[model samples]
Target: MGTLNLSFQIQTLYMSPSSPSFNTFTISLTTNRKKSNCSRFSLSMGNPNDTHTKLVPGAAGFLLQDVPHFTDYLDHLPIVVHKESARGVHFRRAGPRQKVYFKSDDVNACIVTCGGLCPGLNTVIREIVCGLYHMYGVRKVLGIDGGYRGFYAKNTITLTPKFVDDIHKRGGTILGTSRGGHDSVKIVDRIQDRGINQVYIIGGDGTHKGAAVIFEEIRRRGLKVAVAGIPKTIDNDIPVIDKSFGFDTVVEEAQRAIKAAHVESESMGNGIGLVKLMGRYCGFIAMYATLASRDVDCCLIPESPFYLEGKGGLYEYIGKRLKQNGHMVIVIAEGAGQELLSKSLQSVDQQDASGNKLLQDVGLWISHKIKEHFAKKRMPINLKYIDPTYMIRAIPSIASDNVYCTLLAHGAVHGAMAGYTGFTVGPVNGRHAYIPFNRIIEKQNKVVITDRMWARLLSSTNQPSFLKPRDIAEAKKEKYPANGILDGKIVKTMSMN
Candidate 1:
């Protein structure tokens, strides 16, 4: 018996708006070992809780040398995390021998999809199954039949590599999907009953929230099972991730609808084409689609409110565009224009199983208004309203999405195998990493109207501002007079003025 001595040097580079700081430290370890034995061990940079520690390039590259080099056969591998910080954005990458926390051959893994169907659900599911079977040599993969409910409902189907080999050629999940199954305790009970060690939940924000609860319940029960999710928002509204699965397909599909609308509108005398995209709380789909398809004349999103009837409002803008060019194309998100048309925030007597409010149909509402606005005119106005949400979401994903979904699935599986639970495999700066569930659900991602993307969209479209800057200033003045309001008297005087 002898001893082995290992020494490593760590160099950290801090980047900021002011300057860059470079620091280096050396770490060494010595342990007694048999001369004939090879150590099967792993190296960690620093304490996981130390958010300030930054692992520089040299250290990461050195650590890569010690890991297995099986990634040579893979076409695309995750890049390395060069810099780490807490203040702003961070980059993440994977090493050759990333940790596989669940290393047993009999590990039971369940895959479930929740919420609506997207373009690449089948592709992700198939990749997950194949990765588990071939890479990790795990043969016990189960597909939950109907999302979260399938956990407690005892509806599952055994999945194998052969079963999912050609699934990527199809759309939607073979296991099916639904919403409103947030029974954490019951789901954990089902996991324990089946002896499942890893669960992959594929869905949007709501599904992630449910996953967080399920993870918490597993922890409360003192269980070791891991729960991971792949961000499935077709709207691309998940925060921190550069893009979610199916978003590229969504933008591509939405372009077709926009092209059709443009052709139909340009063919008529005073034509207008209205398109409503799927974005409930965010407008990434509509915004990106408008930018991609340059035929759009006006773009309205939930992040930017529009007026129907005032100076420089939606109605006036459409009328002006018709007079100028004889045709107009307007792209509006499904969640857009709700505040302007609806008197209250209440849903229109419709609720889903998840208890979410069914959004009012903004497309139909705007369509009727356009007709009424031009009804009395002698010159005929032809307005086409298109809602292609289901059609777009049902189709197959493009090449870009296929690659992105594959990477997301791989990242999730790696995280789950490495004992990383309660996190979603999302991208930061176009690299896949395990993003915590709380960060995903803490805040909603929305289009910033002030950003360059929105500015480019507005300039490219050349549409009238639905609500102008001066109008916003005047509204603020009307609410609060120049002279401070002493009481009701000041309000009355301001009204008189």
Candidate 2:
């Protein structure tokens, strides 16, 4: 991994101390950069100089003095690097700027949460409200009652420090949430009507798309509104960011369910405990929980496909595990084995209000299948199915997530105040950065079956990869279409039989 050394000059506009005029200065710096998909990494609002409207001249005194700020105009964090390209992708480092586009007292902001519920929602909401009030001295903040539709359909509530002081201790959002009521025109109209200069939207992929549209509409009308998104998903599927806000909390909470399943399976002879977790497109939750709880014998996820009734399929693995240990635990992500279920049940694909696919209950279906397979073999097995999808989501965030949510909320507030619109805030490479909405919403982050983490999970469970040579070939082609080369030795162990 060779580092690319680069040098560039950053032109910045700052207020002159001697005169009441903005002066431009150029600073050159040479540093090492990595290669990635840099094409879409730039913010959608275009150049920061063109996107911002000048604040009142004397309002510069309101800038926070104690807090550290990113004085450099070119401060950015590179996204994941790949060997294919030397051009590195980067996101603007998220924090307060020395000079802001909006005045403190003149700013009017609104916060809204859309899409499904997740842990740390209320915490993010609370931090955003409190960050504006205490950090920037912005007093007027309104909470959009529901999701996007609330912009025009529902009433707004005044949010203050006292109002959101203790909301972090609670689960869900105080502003409430919904799915798929996005009307960009109506939403922007309400923001303009209510004098909202800063709009904070919290949700998953769909909500961010809506925010991007709202930002576009606001920009088209030449409004000074800053639409910031805090990516929220229990599945940890949002890309560009290291992970979403509620992911650590969800992974922490999922352990409780896995522990119970382990206890149940260990209690009875030939007991099979099946646990289903939330992961619509990816199996991060299931993979992480299984790794955390070493009791799992097999972990099934959407990325790694598995088939039954074969020589070395899921049925054979389960039988072998039960015969060896007398009891076994299995964890399956909700989206895992969907193709198998559809093939067995001949079901049609359906979507929810937010355009997310409606997933069938994999736990129950797998449990039945295991029982049927064992019964035909004259084997008696007791199966207990557990689904903790909502339970984990409805709980308050853990200690680490609470702190993470605060950082995310504060990052969003700083970006919006600095006139960075159409961007979402999250940590890229362990540093918080403002990511464009298109970058995050363009593709989903999935558990890479060929990655070391997934390999570690498979090694821990002592389960077959359940992947054939064709699966390996497809994964390699999809991930590295340009080179047709995979970094790992996954293809060598593809013999499931």
Candidate 3:
């Protein structure tokens, strides 16, 4: 085991609009290239057998070994962070309060929770308000109602200690959020006139570009305003942070749902279940669930190809399940094989609350296909459930991620007080963290998803993440050998792959 190195800086290279073509621009971040540098975060776990333990970062997480760069590593390392507007602004914080002038402390800072809600949002917001007023001694903490729309329509009000006193354990943000708000010159002017020097935005990646627009516009007006982004998405797709706050909650929730499906799938004499998770373009939530809950016969993700025919991935899984336990549960990410494999995406009509195209239920669609495939033989008893709504996003409380959220929130407050602007706080090593407030408007993060994660996923595929026990229980007597998907195939994969 050796020292851990996992810090990076964001640098953006391009941007494009959503049309018949790509909607989001590719981004990047620079991390210390240490293929040979071992991450000591995981090595602290003294022994592999301990079930109840905590592994801190920079401990004994890795072992020293000669390393070589992969052929496609550069392709995956394209984007980490990007701020289209803030890269061009500069404003010193107003000095400490004087009778004739207001200090940065006097300048108000407010946070708005917007767009479709995700897990762990309240935890982030709670830390913001509590850390801001109590720790920093800044008085006003505004909670804008209904997201970006609230900001545009001037539907703002002040938040207080009483407002965030007990919000950490809650599900949704007290300020609420709307995806409809537009960032405009008029909006930025209003924010400046109101004496708000800093604005905290907590939302998915969609809201980040808008935040950039406001910061840029404010700086253009020669205002000393700073804006910070807190990433929130159940998909856990954001690239900069080692992992977003809501990811744990979403995975926990998905694990529970998969367990239920597994139980039912196994109870039947002949059965099959397909559990679909909510993931649009990113497969983090889906991949994490598969890793956490090993109950599924086969796991499918959008990042990688899934084969349902012949004797490969999907077909073999069902055949083995029927031979051993007679029933099996399958876990899938909604975005996995979307337009090509998901009926939800292929449906002629779909829409969400705000009238956006509905990301249909991938679970049901997969289940139908399995049923159709096996029904001709009269051998399958299939049941399916889509973990839609708030199942994964409404988790109660988890210590590991709760601690991470607390640190991020508290760190953001510190950043504000220290006059750190246009930067974000996120975990670096498992324990240590970093800040990315640059010297000036600069390139955004260059964060591209790494295939290392995908490789780990493939190697672990046959081993069956935490699911070997249930898989063994349901697996039929191995008169035939498909050594790949059974026991001993699983080696320890305790880290967040």
lDDT of each: 0.72, 0.76, 0.55
Model 3 residue runs over 4 Å out of place are 1-105, 342-358, 386-389, 430-497
Winning candidate number (lDDT): 2
Greater TM-score among 2 and 3 belongs to 2
> Residue by residue across 434-472, what tens digits does model 2's lDDT show?
776777787998988877899999899999998899999
TM-score of each: 0.80, 0.82, 0.66
* For model 1, the run of ten residues with the poorest summed lDDT: 484-493
Candidate 1 lDDT, 114-225, residue by residue in tens: 9998999999998889878877888999999988888777668999998988888887889998889678888888888888988999988889888888877776666767
* Runs off by more than 4 Å, candidate 2: 1-84, 480-497
Which residue pairs clash in candidate 2? none
Error of 1 at 434 (Å): 1.1
Ranked by lDDT from best down, the candidates are 2, 1, 3
By TM-score rank, best first, the candidates go 2, 1, 3
